[model samples]
Target chain A: MSAIYKRELNAYFTSPIAYVVYAVASFFAGLLFVATVLEGDTSDMTYLFRNMTTIIIMMIPILTMKLFSEEKNKKTEQGLLTAPVNLLQIVMGKISAAVTVYALLMVLFIIYALIISFFVTPSWVLIGSNILGLLLFGTTLIAIDTFISSLTESQVIAAILSIGAGLLLTSISMFKNMVDIDFVNDIIDSIEMMGRYENFTLGMVKFSDVIFFLSISVLFIFFTIKVLERRRWN
Target chain B: MIEVKNLVKKYGDKVAVNNVSFTVNEGEILGFLGPNGAGKSTTMNIITGYLSSTSGTVTIDGCEILDDPKGAKSKIGYLPEIPPLYQDMTVKRYLEFVYDLKRVTLPRKEHLAEVCKVTKITDVYGRVIKNLSKGYRQRVGFAQALIGNPPVIILDEPTVGLDPKQIIEMRNLIRGLGKKHTVILSSHVLSEIQAVCDRIVVINNGQLVADESTEEITTNFTGMKRIQLHIDGNDNTVLMTLRDVDGVTRVRKVMRTIDGFTEYIVESKAENDVRKAIFRAMAKVDCPIVMMRNAEVSLEDAFLRITAGETQVNRKGGR
Candidate 1:
């Protein structure tokens, strides 16, 4: 797992995608921060968190586009699979590597908060909560992207599907109108990733929301491994 | 070192490998020969634990791959048909990643050094694999399989896309690996199999129909032996006269324009030697038999007969 993690993290920086992801996400997040904090007379950072989610969606695809898709395409999957490690170790290693990059981006965002603390005033509690939310939210996105990347051999297809899946999951709150159907509305709100994110950004630690995000991430990671395992037989 | 039993891999309704079973002893080189999509890749994939079998069991070095995958997989090293490689990584870096993933003992710098020496790619190790020639990339791939010092190595078409010189080099490298590990080299190339393997496993239409020593498969699969006869006579009458010989299964004209005479090719039953009879028969026909030679079965003929019969006969473990 450590080996795979190092390899993936190195790949992120070796290519231009890592810098591009950070530049694009941090740019818009900074703008949203100024508008929500100054013009709107609010430091709630709900808007900041919302923008961070969007950044993650677009950037995570670029981050994970090469994970398994490129391996399969380049025929490097044989090298990895034939190696002595188990499937779980390999999958976890790749995820950890992507998460490391995501963590680096989060650290950059935290630095932005530190700058805000010096210039105006930083809500450390809210900032702390947001970081936690970012980790949870980032992992969820990475899990989805990783799974999508594993499903195809084409990087373009994997990237597009990951972006689309991220959008779909984040937009689950749109189905709240189905409150007319009590059960359906309950399920959507429970699975609603953005709805769950609101609590983390607001500095309220909700156990159910935390568990839901992690659960979703774990579920997809397991699915990705299963998809990979099935490939051996066919 | 490897055992496969009743292995059947199906993609939906289409079977890729059907009821394939074979064994490889320690330090033996087993060759898998088949046509394209002949399940050569699928079988290798299953044996290496890359893909789960639809219905089968694979045991490597006494450990079942499915029951204890990590244990079984650790003993096996597979080079897939395409030499799956990460192009962006340097050859050495890629091998390093393979070593890491293979979980070799750390701090054993000597093991790593020895593998590079064996593959003879130390000079090219520092360069990105994307920039290396296909031959070098293949050697680097072989180097990856050699990591962890696994006891079993399975190489699928290891020399598929190489120049003639590189192909020979790759064969020598594989043969060297065979001395230390149980190696399975899968290819449709007949000479590669005949040259490198101790035993041959021939599969056709996803079935293991022939698994025997190379010579045994050659002798049994090609049911008839071939002979070349140079007859001092006109083409038509010599052909007619040889066709009537008792032990001949087939008679064909190998050449008629060599020196203004016909050269007949006679295929006799596998167990029968009709050379002396044809010699005397030609003498009596007043058509002098200048020279007669029997042609042993080649790997090409063995592969064709085995694969062709695998589709047609559906034989049940006929020894």
Candidate 2:
């Protein structure tokens, strides 16, 4: 698992995707910080973190687009599958690699928060919770995006489909208002990803919300392994 | 040692491999000879644990591939038809990654250096795989297979796209590897297998047609003796005289030479030495014999005969 993780992490840095993702993510975070905190005359980062959800949702697919798709295209999956390693190890290695890249992006946000601290005092607890929320949210999306990447051999298609899936998961709660049935609305509200994240943005680290994200991530990782295993039989 | 017993692999409705079975004893080089789409790669894939057989088992050293994949896979090294290479990685880094991926316990630096030296890719070790030529990329693929020093090495058409010089080099490398490892090399080229392998298993249309030692296949299929004759006489008289020989089964004119001699191939029964009879018969007809020699039956002819459904030459288990 560590071997695959190290190779995958090195692959991200060796290619231009890592730098491109970092640049685009930092540009958006800086743009949001300047527009929301500087001009709005507010030290509260809740609005900034809240608005960054869309950016995280859109940017994660780029980070994970080539995880398995590139392997399939280049036929390197044969080597990995034939090696003396289990399917779970391969899936975890890729997930860990993408999560490391996502963690680096989050670190840039903490740097932005530190810059905000020079002038006025900001609540570190709020910043901590927001960062934690984004991390969990981003990781769950990463798992889903990685699973999507494993489904196809084309990296462009994987990225596009992953973005579509991420947007649908985050915005599915909006359909609750359109439906008249109370049970349907409650079901949509229960499963929506963004709704569970709202608690963390308000400085509440709910255990149930954390478990939701963790379990979703695990479920998607499991799906990715199953997809790979099924491909062998094909 | 590797034993593939009654291996059968099906891709949906199309049966790619049909009850194919063979084995490679320790320290032996077994050649898998087949035409295109003959289930060579599919069989190799199943044996390597990359694909599951529909209803079969591959036992490597003592572990079945499906039952103990880790144990089975650790004992074998496989090079597929196309070398699985990461284009963005340098050869050195790729080799290192394969080493780590295989969890080799050997001293890293020395083992990699030895593999590079053996495959003669030490010069391109630091270059990115994308920039290297096809031959170099192939050698890099070979280098990765040698990383763990596994006992069983399976190469699927290892010399597919190489030049003649590189093909010779690859064959020599495979021959050298056969000394320490049990090797199974697959190829469509008849002479390549005839020159390199100790035993040959011929597969055609997903069926094992012939399995025997390299020399035995030719001799077994050489049951009908063929003799070539060059006669400097009239074609009809030479043909009739050669046909009149007691042991001559058939006679056909091959070609007319520029030196006023006609070439003909005369086939005889298996136990007949019809050369003397043909000489005496031709002399009686006043047809001067220019040249006469026994036509050597090559592996190419044997392969053509076997794949054409003319012979069944399985020597395994005396069946």
| Candidate DockQ scores, in order | 0.61, 0.65
- Backbone clash pairs for candidate 2 read none
Least accurate 10 contiguous residues by lDDT in model 1 chain A:
A37-46
| Per-residue lDDT value at A200 in model 2 | 90
The estimated TM-scores of all candidates read 0.86, 0.89
Per-residue lDDT of B131-187 in model 1, one digit per residue for the tens?
988888788878878888889998989998999999998889888888899999999
Q: What share of the true interface contacts does each candidate keep?
A: 0.86, 0.69
- Judged by DockQ cut-offs, the docking class of candidate 1 is medium
**Interface CA root-mean-square deviation for model 1:** 1.7
For candidate 1, give the lDDT of residue A95.
94
Error of 1 at A45 (Å): 3.9
Top DockQ hit: 2
Evaluated against the true chain A, what TM-score does chain A of model 1 have?
A: 0.93
Candidate 1, residue A181: CA error in Å?
A: 2.0
